[model samples]
Target: MASRVTMIAHLFGAMATILMLVWLLHYRGGIDLDSDSNSDRIFNVHPFLMFFGFIFIAGEAIMGYRTVAAERKVQKLFHMVMHLIAITLGIIGIYAVFKYHDEIGLSDMYSLHSWIGLGTFCLFGLQWLFGFFSFWLPKSSLATRETMKPWHIFGGRALLYMAICSALTGLMEKATIMGLKRGNESRLINFTGLFILLFGLAVDLSLSLAY
Candidate 1:
């Protein structure tokens, strides 16, 4: 039962992420197939997905961790933090893009946002590398443990902080997209995610006792 529930959560999280990525890559973020939109409007869809997607993904990671062994729990927690950070950086990038809307070049905000995003991606890359090489490591090597453990933990937390800032940036981007207007749409989206995350956490807590 626990496995089934966990699998369902994973599936939902993955589906949400794929939808978000597709929406962002095509219409928002990067410069491709030039469109008739200003800097303020550029990140509409990207931030939209980012705000909501991060919430869901974060929740999945947290709930999923409950099912793992104590030893593996740390690794799972690190993965959660890494992803949370990546989402955050993306959020911040959305804001930075808007802040430098009139600059028309590499602005300071853009530079900082880009670097933070790059770092987040790098850490995520390392996480994937560690996962891929997990079986090949020698038992006697301290290097593998150190890299996989402490480095990942620190990287993950840094990533989380970045992600929160990114989310704030995304919110700003959304407001700009609507011409300094505020609406319930973005709020609703975020609230939906919050609800899902909270509900998932509740379910996991309940089931933990049974398991």
Candidate 2:
């Protein structure tokens, strides 16, 4: 059952990523580190990275234990590694948006979406640090590990949910700012959002059912 749900989550995640790429490359212009000529191109990286890089990676990290047949230590290592990758990609995504805002002369971190997104990212980093110290190198004592286990799991789940919330809000904000009312672009945006939501839900359900 968990495997089936994980497959579905993978399918949805793939669809969301494809739709996102099509929207950015075909409509919004391809992503770049810093497209001075077109800041919109720079902005495209924000959503793609946040959805695929951060949220999707974190989702896989959350579900990997249920799906992989690895030893306990291996699974734990993989989980931590995935989260690290997610953080790297997440920070890059955040940077893209901040750079975009600067290029356009817009004030940074003003909107509700930015507030939630930045807050989530910061908390995510802190969570990773806590996890690393508690479970990874210079590990805590066995009793301490057992004591912190539940809180660790809860924090991981909570941060993933917050990331999803940020992604949804960011998507809507971009859609509204672009005034994509009734066009292929608008439809694509809506569909991407739908798949993203479905992917997150599937990930959450798969995790719950796994245990």
Candidate 3:
């Protein structure tokens, strides 16, 4: 059951990435880091990285234990590495948005989307640190790891939902700003949001079934 759900999650992840690319390349202009329209291009990086690099990779990390038939240590190492990569990309994604705002001379973190997105990113960082110290390192006792396990899992699940909320809100905010109203772009945005939501759902379901 868990394996099946994990596969579904992976499918959703791929769908989300394709939709995001379509939205950015077809709807918005193609990405350009050094062009005169760098602001818009840089802003495009935020959604791409956040969705594919951060959320999708993080989901895969969560499903690693259930999906991969590897040794415990191997699974743990892969999970941690995936999360670390996700965090690194998440940082770049956040920076991209901030750089876009700076280029446009707009204030940052003024919208609810930014507020939730930034807050979730901070919490994710803290969660990663706690997991690293509590489980990955041998400095902590087995009892300590057992005590922290539930909290870690719960926090991760909560953070995943928070990320999904951030993504959905960000998409809506962008659509409104771009004046998308009943068009192909708007439909693509809606489908992208649905895939994201489905990905989160599949991850959560897989985790629940695994345990």
Candidate 4:
């Protein structure tokens, strides 16, 4: 069951990543969210896709932490401290998005979104590196392993949720500012999220059975 859950989470994470990569490409290619004016302040689909996309990241992080915890190779204190730091940074980032929301436009917010997304990406990237490389803790003691897990899990999960909220809020703000009803624009994002989630679960279940 645990292995199944882990695989499911990984698949969702990968699908979300693909969506994000495509969105970035479209944005770079001058594909405006609105078909008309590139500078139009209207709210569109990007926010929906970007924000909810964090779920995949969060799910994966949870699975990874559980794996480490089950191993009992590390101390909990270290993991707790890392989580505190990551949450602190994530909260600040979330606050920054709302605080500057009034002063920022949708197009401008996209820029902000990119930067914030990068922050989340960096945290997860670090987590992946540590997991695969096992460089986070030396082979010395259980205490050292415990210390590394907190930071790895907390930092990654916090950033993921932060990005999720930040993106969704930006969409709401944009819709309000432009007086445009674009709730439908978010449908694609919603569908993609569901699809990725289901697909992931299936993969995880299958993998668990095989194992």
Top-lDDT candidate index: 3
lDDT of 1 by residue, 76-105 (tens): 655456555645644554454444453456
Greater TM-score among 2 and 4 belongs to 2
Across 99-202, the per-residue lDDT of candidate 2 in tens digits comes to 88888899998899999999999999999999899989765799999999889888877887888889889889989988778988999988998999999899
Return whichever of 2 and 3 wins on TM-score: 3
Q: Which ten residues in a row have the lowest lDDT in candidate 3?
A: 30-39
Better of 1 and 3 by lDDT: 3
Whole-structure CA lDDT of model 3: 0.91
TM-score ranking from best candidate downward: 3, 2, 1, 4
Alpha-carbon shift of residue 88 in model 3 (angstroms): 0.5
Off by over 4 Å in 1: 1-45, 48-55, 58-115, 130-148, 186-211
Residue 38, model 3: Cα distance from true site in angstroms: 3.8
Clashes by residue pair, model 4: 74-145, 74-146, 75-146, 78-147, 79-150, 82-151
Score residue 9 of candidate 1 by CA lDDT. 57
- What ranges in model 3 sit over 4 Å off? none
Deviation from native of the Cα of residue 159 in model 1, angstroms: 1.6
Cα distance off (Å), candidate 3, residue 145: 1.1
TM-score of 4: 0.40
Winning candidate number (TM-score): 3
TM-score of predicted model 2?
0.95
Q: What is the lDDT of residue 166 in candidate 1?
A: 49
